[model samples]
Target: MGGQQSRQKHVALDDPESKYVIPQNTHKIKGLSRYMSAKADHDRIVATRGWDKHDENMQSMQMLKGLFKNLDPTVMKAVGDIRGDIQLSFKYDFKRQLLLIKVIRCRELPSKDWRSKMSDPYVMVRLLPDTNRQGEKKTRVVQQCNNPTYNEIFAFQLDELELMDMKLLVQVLDKDIISRDDVIGEVIIDMNTFKFKENPVHTAWYMLNKETDLSITGEIDITVAFQMPQSLFVTIHRATGLAARDEGNASDPFVKLTIPGTSVLYQTQVLKKTLNPEWEETFEFPIALEELEDRFIIFHVVDEDVSSSNDSLGQAIVDLKDFDPDRGMHGSYKLADLRNTERIRSKWFQRITAEEFSEALYAHSMSKQPSFIFQNQRTGKRVNCIVSS
Candidate 1:
């Protein structure tokens, strides 16, 4: 017999799903064997094409690697060199309850805009939560300089006991008038880490960081001083050029003297509705001689409020070094608003004279005596005798 004639079948290319509907069990061995062979051939072809395409891709990648390897090392280095963090310094005056932050300089600042080739940088400092709005402070912008030298000082009022809860935040930013300012980096300092008791004054350099990276942006130098004990005597004589805090009426002003480290506070009697008020009040404190170098006598002029908290008229901080124990300092000191340097009022402070101080001591001693008198035997005249042991 002649070889079995092969059967030819045709299926629509667009309607391939129609082939699956054919009775698969009825075809049995022959149909299943033919289907398996055809599937194997198709799979082999697909594998061969995929291999060839993969090889071509591998070759292309190797060529790209060789080209990149031939690039100049300096160009690669330039791409790797990015900007870093910044540094700051701080100084705390325990006696005045003042925290001073000094923006000394910033180094290795990356150029914010690649085309500009430089940055206009400034520093913004804030105590977190900036509740009073006055807690935020800033330094002047240095134009087009990557390494900027500010050497500017900003001050904050803080209690010595509350230093543990304080956190200082410093931000380095690139200034832009046309657009929003860009933040280069920032640092947060925990004031509690400092040992103020052991070393009353100390300086340290802190490395700045961005996120979790140890960036080499720059460093900051900080100095802190705790108040020591010292003897101080202050007299609030009078104030002039006082602004009226009350609406349409002159202020009822009084003077207050405070020692920040200690709970000692002294106040003068209030003077009613006067532009120029004379207090002539004297207050004294025994302080450590070593602490005198950092101590300041603060004079606060307040407008007495009957219904609410007293409003501050003005204030002045006098350095102890400015006063001489024997000669005493007597002059007019310009009064400024709290946390601000702009003068708002003028005030005169005069230390009591040696003769006056002696008289005061004598009077204080005599107040304890019930009855005492002295008679001059030679002149037959009576004189007052006050004695102290």
Candidate 2:
């Protein structure tokens, strides 16, 4: 190999023309250079801003804008071209006290991408004045389509008066993975206008209108357990996104639990100055297992005020029949607006008139001052209600 290379070197020197020969046409090996440049840039960034800052910047880039609300470019396009109609059907089950709503489909929906005439649409249904978010339901997203068919049914548990007063809000939104979902259109249906019983299956096509008011509130986590023959336990886990009721945009919050048709009120210790409070406090109630069937528990979130009575932040109602005797129930519930004590008392009175209970007396609304006491000599069941103003 040395002799051959020496001969070639001598020939090349003798020829002198080899020096003038054009170099072979070759592509540049740019991959390693590009990689080295990137590595240098990365190293400089890490050295200048530390690993923690570097990682934070990278994470921020991948974070989602949000799940819904707050209009963006794509959403704006859909909102402007809101020309569509939605089909819906309604049915009420008298025995279960549930109103079933079926989101049939959407037709002639406006395309988010005008060039391709494509859209991604879904339906969000809720009962108006839903304080606890228990009446909200949503459909799956249908992608790259102008018309989407979603024959989905959602059920809401409500009393007769509540059903009469409630309205159904149906919103058609365009699904966007990059940012908040765009609101294409919405429609509000008044329950009182429809005769759900006589017309049993009330199906109609509602014209999509402009977006309505969007009111949102905080949520609370709670768990309920049944301890056999006559004991009920409740735990207030935590609360998030609570509304500010005091100065400096904070609240000293506490929870009050009460069961109707019984003189039971349980409260948790107050926490100081926070929008999100975690109180893993539990309380118990003395009641028989059989009595839970037609009963409801009310959870009231209040802000403790040293100067005056505590201010109510919100309230929630849970039907005790939903609880499993063996396992009980646990959930993160949305808080609803607190109604007046008179309104709550009137509702309780309506229940008493409807149901056949032998010598039953109950007092509720822990925020109220007045309470009643009654005893039935025939049944020998004494009812006592003691509440604070």
Candidate 3:
């Protein structure tokens, strides 16, 4: 298709970089001729700050201006927002198939550096059980963050994990610690679909009132484990009633558990309060299972005023099959042999009074040096305790 006949003496403009003689309606580069286009584009954001991105971020630190005592711990410590976004991801390899699980995001909402939006979530590790091998069982592992920072990211691999335990024990670290009540928010991802799960099972959170003088010291080993099918046990409160208040509006403060649109397992909203901080409780609920198709262990906080979300206090995704179930025993585990072993376990703790220990032992605080041993009637394990006045 060469110039067949110079049909109409055609002329074409070949100026690729030319900014001159631009059409009126088209983009005119009149001002562009004076400055470098690349520089001008990038400089738009810099012109206002007059500093590099890193420096701008540093300068943005506004000396943490708010009620210092009221804000969350992170802001109280003199740091601005989180250094970066928070992430939690892990994977399981079973029979050549890969199972990936991760938290999509845990961003702080726009309230006081997002402290109100902060969440203390439960983390677990599970190694898929081998069905072919009947004798072998699944293993579940549960873990709690010792010092959970905002948007804290975590990644780990459970080596040959389940044959014993594969679930994570996530114990929230804060001023108030409740088995199911500490939940303030959640960051969840679906196991099957690999999508973000909004309302998860056994969501947990905790809070410390500004007026309370409850003093906690050292690293109070927060533990997470499923003591039974419907109930999960959490141990926190090194010292609960520092203000010496009785069980009232400020005293009998308990973790109110309520699953959204579902019936509550705990018949009462008041579990235990500030009267005794050393006391611990287990919240039993018919939730979190593996073999079931209609999964629902998901829940939120109990609001006395409303029927809807009490701001959805945190979230958790739990698989009963992937957790180390605490059936209570001193002997080796084998569900069939549980009843037989219970006898031996009972004999061991027979000398120890369960009711007395449950009540009297609560007088001891973790902060003080131990003066007595509190044994579990079922497991026969002794808990070190100390009296604090």
Model 1 quality (TM-score): 0.34
Task: Please give the lDDT score for candidate 1.
Answer: 0.56
Rank candidates, TM-score, best first.
2, 1, 3
TM-score of 2: 0.38
Best by lDDT: 2
Give the Cα RMSD of candidate 1: 41.2
lDDT of 3 at 124: 27
Per-residue error (Å), model 3, residue 274: 1.9
Please give the range of 10 consecutive residues that has the lowest summed lDDT in model 3: 331-340
* RMSD of each predicted structure: 41.2, 34.3, 31.2
Model 3 RMSD, rounded to 1 decimal: 31.2
Relative to the unseen true structure, what is the C-alpha lDDT of residue 268 in candidate 1, on a scale of 0 to 100? 76
lDDT for each of the candidates? 0.56, 0.66, 0.29
In the predicted model 2, the residue pairs found to clash are 131-336
